[model samples]
Target: MSQEIESGELDALLPEGTVVRIAGNNRTKWDLVGKKGVVRNAQTLGGWHEVVLEGSTSAVRVQRNALEIIAIIPHSKVKLAGSLQGIKSGDQSSITKRRKKKQSPPMAVNLGKLDEDTLRRYRRYFNLNVRKDCEKDELVFAVRRHFARTKVDESDVIFRFLTRIGKFPE
Candidate 1:
């Protein structure tokens, strides 16, 4: 038996470029529920409409009922705030040469060797729940372990932490 939904309803609810989250009892694909993806195309397939996600090389078809529209990706617009009359011509060669220079790798610090006072200061500044007796490596491990449990991206958390500590340049 066909359980087809109206094409009009699908068109009205999920327009192209609209970001959607998968929501249903499809156990194997539950990992996709919270992840946002842009709608590339929609087509009627048998009893259901299949949606293709952007940046997806495979034409994996997702049923219409599984999708929940979350957001729409906005196009960026460049606005000129001042007049371009006073702008001077820059040396293109210098700009190109600068781009060719290789950046130095970041220096690695031995977290296990940090002093108690420094660790205490970091814990106080970042408002971390790390113990007073914990060494630098232990503190780092604890923070990462907590972050993993919280489902927060480690890179983003580290970036924010660095920014809060004034280690990240503005």
Candidate 2:
């Protein structure tokens, strides 16, 4: 049975929980060549993506270019509480669960790592008001607020960032 889906539903950068098949010609990952797996992490290290093979608990890292996206697991299934059945939360010494930090989009998306000057420059490019005397945190917060206020496509935001950083030709 073919599980082919519409190309419009797929994106080049696979999101987490996206099912994928390793390419047959993937010379580096010959052992698992042509195997199917679900994406656990999109960007584990540089261009590497972590994938969990069928019937496996442990995940393996595969190059992004070597994987072909099969299907995207709906957000409803992925966001249903915790999905891990047997994996430990890694708090052996503590009895209480660790509270997840409340973060804005800038911190959530790692935009805080960018220097204040760079952030200010990008804000200017985006037509965001920036004060020369304002703190770096405030600038980052504004960026977070801008996205959080609207229903913006994350991939588009990432693409814009890449273009601003000159990583991609405009």
Candidate 3:
């Protein structure tokens, strides 16, 4: 899901205090997905960008794919508009859009974050076809694959309503 923005556009974004959103809810990431934050420094950990969310002290190492440019803070309004040319919120030609790749398997680390009993209970409640004898890793894979088949931002009102209320787990 790596985006291919022009280097000049990206360079304009490397300044500190630039605003950004955690992109791609479908991309494997921490709960920061869909959250916004400010660039803390002009540094990259391999491909990861370091940013700090509001009310958080330490920098969050956001993966490159998870980082979406929102605003360039240091630029004047005119300069900012120029820098962000071609970037539009929710446009089909969104700079964030990349060619659809095969769905990635969910990270096992997400499973590790939950207590084992909770994992089993949720899986059971969801009625996932995973067997009782299956290992936790297998169950994780099965559950993620199942969810991947579901669509996002659709016309189903009930699903959107449930999502708006945070009733469904991300």
Candidate 4:
């Protein structure tokens, strides 16, 4: 039996065990009401964030700006997990503390032999300013976010990351 949903009734229907994966724009201003264990993964939820909630057997993409819900898999009823652990943005202490901790030495990479265009692209993209006292590995890790955030083709980005980290699949 389907009942008429009132104001705030839809949010109330969110049962426990919902895994919300957000991307693109709606990552910033979403709030979970009458629910706990809402997980968020995004660099920033600035513009139009896209949220995908995966149920046990199905998933739904919720557009916050438009307040629209696109359901996946109609007949096969899916169960949302109720017992999820909540993850929140880390506090300032953790971020700053980690930065203060010294990083280990860098591995030998023959920086001079690296291709000129490859060097230029990474240098421009990363805006790296190496200091004599700074460690090479730390410099790379520090600019890792810039490398991660560069606007590259989606397929290329995946390939580049996997290649840089050397995590190729068999």
Candidate 5:
């Protein structure tokens, strides 16, 4: 089945609950949802964070945000959430070099450590219910949709959302 998926014809036909590898030229794989995930700018970078959703080649990369690499995971994979540690400060240039040496893949991070105050702020501003078990991407999309509808600045809602999900500023 993995072989068939690698062949590309069945890429679009991949079943909803199936686990597929997402990577770039580096060959480091990140898990992704066949649907239900939203790609957006990480609030800190001001339009630099993006999760590319394509068949077989999906990846998350930092362009204008930071020198780090990011991986987007489905809410169902929250089990892997605890590993989402943002790149250490000043380590941006080393990500690519480390990859070239076949070093261990970047760490995955969990979103549960966000401050309660930040979470409350997000909930109050967006009218979202960001309970402790809520999925990160779901909260992000909810805020994105709300901002789009109300013509509000993303800063008003994005910071609190990212804090909850454990993603760093762009």
Candidate 6:
């Protein structure tokens, strides 16, 4: 989630015609991330801002944190354009779209560097035998698969574990 913004500040900052990206977990009617939209109008409704996305008949009421201003277009220059038009305009021949990269296998974890408490927590959370003499790469692969299945963000989990283990000072 993006940082929260006050209604007054948002109103002042994002006048009509500001181009914004849907950084928050907002899905459009098409069931896709809204991706990009121009601010057609802004209104203060309770604690939320009812913002009208360009080309849409309905407006979405969301907190300031839900909206991220990508570009501020002057009201005079606010033209109804497709979301991808800006990206398509620049150096057409030089631009080449590439397929998404594949995710490599997780790297091996150094169990020796982990303290006893950290190791215990890792075992408890991942339900693995830490004392296993098997390949470290295999353990890492299993842990990665578990995390993927649970939809856990690896960086956040690792950071919390490190902080708890005193690797990162409070």
Candidate number with greatest TM-score: 2
Give the per-residue lDDT digits (tens) of candidate 6, residues 1-170. Answer: 13344444554535666566555644333342454566656555533444555456455655555666655555687654434234222322321123345456886655455555554556567777545554555555555566456666889999999999999987
CA shift of 102, model 3, Å = 22
Off by over 4 Å in 2: 1-12, 24-27, 79-170
Off by over 4 Å in 6: 1-13, 25-34, 47-59, 81-170
Candidate with best lDDT:
2
Worst 10 residues of 5 by lDDT: 1-10
CA RMSD per model (angstroms): 22.2, 16.2, 16.0, 20.2, 22.4, 17.0
Q: For residue 26, give model 5's deviation from the true position in Å.
A: 46
Instruction: Estimate the overall C-alpha local distance difference test score of candidate 1.
Output: 0.50
User: CA lDDT of 39 in candidate 5?
Assistant: 38
The CA-based lDDT of model 2 is what?
0.65
Q: Tell me the tens digit of each residue's lDDT in model 3 across 79-124.
A: 2221223334343332353345445686444555666677688688
Summarize candidate 4's per-residue lDDT along 31-104 as a digit string, tens digits. 43212222222213432222333322222333333232222212233333432223332211111111234445
Clash count list over all predictions: 0, 0, 0, 9, 7, 0
> Model 2, residue 7: what's the lDDT?
44
lDDT per residue as tens, model 2, 1-170: 13444443342456777666777444446888866667787763556777787667678888776776555566555521223333223312211212445344654577789898888887788777767678989899988787577587889999999999999999
TM-score list, all predictions: 0.29, 0.38, 0.36, 0.18, 0.19, 0.34
Writing each residue's lDDT as its tens digit, candidate 1 over 5-108 gives 34444444445554455564453276555443455556655323233433353434466666665444333421122211122223121110112344468855
Q: Which candidate, 4 or 5, would have the higher TM-score against the true structure?
A: 5
With candidate 4 superimposed using the best TM-score fit, by how many Å does residue 162's alpha carbon deviate from the native? 21
Rate residue 151 of model 5 by lDDT.
63
Q: What is the overall TM-score of model 6 with all chains considered together?
A: 0.34
Itemize residue pairs with steric clashes in candidate 3.
none
Q: Point out the worst 10-residue segment of candidate 6 by lDDT.
A: 88-97
